[model samples]
Target: MRMQVDDLSDERVQALIMNHLESMALHSPPESRHALHFDGLRQPDVTFWSAWEGEELVGCGALKELGAAHGEIKSMKTDPRHVRKGVARQVLAHIIDVAKERGYTRLSLETGSMAAFAPARRLYESFGFTYCEPFAHYKHDPNSMFMTKEL
Candidate 1:
């Protein structure tokens, strides 16, 4: 698979992001739905990437700068048809490497606490992220699980 840094203007990338957001909404409670909308992902502070196998979009993820040294993982999703094929792992690893390259000292993320999110939490754990209190503007939320890793 090819990992590409894609601007939000790319139609294929936008479609993938929309699908990701829809999937999140379906599986996550409204209060725990943190996936960004299309406009939000286009923010100057966020860097989005898409993974492609030939012409097919396999997965995508994003990193948003929270401040000078901290970053947040956002919009990690693998095409349902491609699950268990390491697409998410590839996108996540790329995001982490990019954060390190950008000089971020720590990377954090907020994911759902529901059982549906178990695989995602496991992925983060495997990448060395540990549970943490909410960072950024997030407050305590029962539906949310926060995790962070030092770069």
Candidate 2:
């Protein structure tokens, strides 16, 4: 798959972002859903990437700079047809590599606490992220699971 920095204007990428938001709403309550929308991903601090296989979009993820030495992972999603094909893993690894290259000493993420999010949490764990208190503007919430990894 080819990973490219996205401008969030591609209809394919927008559709996937909508699907991701809808899935977040279905699996987690409104207040607990932290997935960003198209506009949200366009912030100066956020860098969005889309993975493509041939001419098809396979997955996408984003990295948000939280501070000089800290970053957050956001909006990770794989195309339903491509799930379990390592689309997410490749996108995530790319984001991590970028974070390290940017001199970030820590990377963190917020995911749902629901069973539906088990695979995502497991993926983060496999990358050496451990449970941690909320970072950035997040606070304690039963529906949210926070994880962090020191670079």
TM-score of each model, in listed order: 0.94, 0.99
State the lDDT of candidate 1 residue by residue for 13-75, as single tens digits: 777788888878888778778898888888999888889999998889889999988999999
| Winning candidate number (lDDT) | 2
lDDT of 2 by residue, 32-140 (tens): 8889888889999999999999999999999999999999999999999999999989999999999999999999999999999999999999999999999899999
Candidate 2: clashing pairs of residues = none
Query: Which residues of candidate 2, in runs, are more than 4 Å off?
Result: none
lDDT of 2: 0.96
Instruction: Compute the lDDT for candidate 1.
Output: 0.90
TM-score of 2: 0.99
Candidate 1's error at 86, in angstroms? 0.5
